[model samples]
Target: MYEQKTKETDQSVMEFIEDIENIKKREDAYKLVDIFTETTGYPAKMWGPSIIGFGAYHYKYASGHEGDAPLVGFSPRKAKISLYFATGETERDKLLQDLGKHTSGKGCVYINKVADINVEVLKQLIDQSVTFLKETYPSE
Candidate 1:
């Protein structure tokens, strides 16, 4: 289980992306940040060293693991950007249809770039994920 580290710092997150001097990646990162905020109405904050997180959700797993995590977050990795969501395939089996081409891991969805996915579908994905998290983990 991922331990809740100290809240992510702006300096750390900024430094983590310092090497990503590629104009395209940097632009995409900013673009995604803006989209995340506009669509979800949750201000974006950098989480840890790389993730741009939005909103928040509390989760307690079946094994008793519990923590507060961003309702949706993403890290612009060197190879791809990760989209975080608080849902498993069971609740998202059909939801992925509209997500365009993307891969999943547990509650996260990974997209190499926004271009690979339909922007409109991505919006729907975020909307559904946020709704699911809000409804399922209202205490957070």
Candidate 2:
């Protein structure tokens, strides 16, 4: 049997943000909290030790691997801020075209700071991710 390490926890999101050593990153984290919360209509939650997530959904794969994950989330890492969004959403790549300066991985968009990207596009990404997840894995 396997278990998920990134399960939601009771850790305080504020404390985590405040503890960020980089002043700019800490400030950006706060702004992101507000942006994600307003965009998703969900409060910020600590996912694992570092990720600040909003909302959640249960997902099961064809291989029987299933777990609950945040609809969208982000982490302020030492190198860059990693934005997490739903994978396999076509609109995501389209929107990223107008998202300003950012590098994206398979599931994360990396930004040096909040000012480096378009906030509106970020909001759209958050909304699209949430909507996609809800549709892909409807609650039972």
Best by TM-score: 2
Each candidate's clash count: 0, 0
Model 1 TM-score relative to the real fold = 0.81
Off by over 4 Å in 1: 1-3, 6-19, 89-91
Cα displacement (angstroms), candidate 2, residue 76, comes to: 0.5
Model 1: lDDT equals 0.75
Best by lDDT: 2
Question: What is candidate 2's lDDT per residue for 1-140, written digit by digit as tens?
Answer: 99899999999999999999999999999999999999999999999999999999999999999999999999999999999999889899999999999999999999999998999999999999999999999999
What are the C-alpha RMSDs, in order, of all predicted structures?
2.8, 0.5
Q: Residue-wise lDDT of candidate 1 within 1-140, one digit each (tens)?
A: 57688354565544555567676777777778878888999877777767878887777889998877888878888777788876642546676777777888876788777877787767777787888888887882
Q: State the weakest 10-residue window (summed lDDT) of model 1.
A: 6-15
